[model samples]
Target: MTDAPVLPSHAYVPGHTARHTEGAFDPIRASVREGMSSKELARTEAFRAGLAFRASGHFWEAHEVLEPVWMACPPNSEPRAFVQAIIQLANAQLKLRMGKPRAATRLCQIALAHLDEVRGEVVLGCDVAALRVEVLALSTSSELQYNA
Candidate 1:
């Protein structure tokens, strides 16, 4: 078979739409994903920043902070799935904050599905089981009081 073209590191990630192409091959994103694969997920500043934003009730910012790391991971990889789960969790919380319970519930379910692929394992320092418990509560509740 002919060899695949040697695209630059800046080439678009597979499955990303054109709108998601900005900085698609960031070096920092690659570094963070590499670190996470070696148990350094919690040590990465970007991951920690996303966690901080999530804990402080800034879900949209948390999603933005974590998205690059997720994007950096190879398709269908565990680290990618974990980061995607966390991003979905962040969006679920944002939906709740916006008073859209149905959308929040759907997002929470999607996040749980991603987390299940990891078999309740820790992701970026988050205890997946504990997070699942909280997310399940959020899914069922009509109101949320996050970190307030």
Candidate 2:
């Protein structure tokens, strides 16, 4: 998806009209930057804000917030992959909202690929294994409903 001209005050859901405007302040955009460890990144307000946005169905905002965390991690690192998986999941949800099941499924596949590199039960406050299962279901399910 293309970046919004400005951060919208309300969450965007495709096919549904919502008034969008500029001047919305985003903490992640204001403060998040590269050069942080996974652990440190997790502790940052920006990371928490990303999670909140994702949980609140603000998929685009979530992606915007989390991208910096992904970039901060070393290339090919588990932390980077994990963060990317989450971002992909958010994007997949956005695609689903846009009524593009094929695109959503494809995004889920990409998320799964990134998740495969992640180890352990948890990372950055998420259950990696559970997330993998959920993404797999989304990738294969006939009904493309995004349940958060």
Candidate 3:
């Protein structure tokens, strides 16, 4: 069978990441403000928290926090798949964080399917496409083979 892809460790070399963190946080904070009501805000806050966890390399925490939101999204819509994709993607991320890139790559394929099916621009502030490109870079990298 064909092998899954892996990313190089140098993927984050574009620039200093922390400088861009504030811009990333803006939409999340906006989402919290634009929520329909307190309940909505609460839910959005949970998602924002999950994003923070994901950014911090705590993929399991991201998964635990995001899975419910993904699962709770209305059954037949882009947002549902988006969240579900995030959950699945987070699982793969957790695998990567734990140094199991092959398993992570497998999970990423599942996550990619859902993410690809999503419509319009990102429903939330999360940059799934950029994340996809990044993950794809890692998943397809030769460096991950033996490490896997």
Worst 10 residues of 1 by lDDT: 5-14
Error of 1 at 106 (Å): 1.0
Model 2 Cα shift for residue 18 (angstroms) = 4.4
Give the per-residue lDDT of model 2 (tens digit) for 56-146.
Answer: 7888778877877887878988888998999999999889878888789889989999998988678877789988887888786766645
Model 1 per-residue lDDT tens digits across residues 2-97: 122122222122233122345533432443654345256555656666666676775765675677678766687766787787888888887766
Looking at model 3, report the run of 10 residues with the lowest lDDT sum.
1-10
In order, candidate lDDTs are 0.65, 0.77, 0.59
Q: In model 2, which regions exceed 4 Å deviation? A: 1-9, 18-26, 145-148
Task: Report the C-alpha displacement of residue 145, candidate 3, in angstroms.
Answer: 3.3
TM-score of each: 0.68, 0.80, 0.64
Candidate 3 local lDDT, 83-124, one digit each (tens): 777677777766665667888788878877887877657566
Residue 104's lDDT in candidate 3? 78
Candidate closest to the true structure, highest lDDT: 2
Candidate 3 at 115: error in angstroms?
0.9
Ranking by TM-score: 2, 1, 3
Q: Which candidate has the top score in TM-score?
A: 2
In model 2, the worst 10-residue window by lDDT is: 1-10
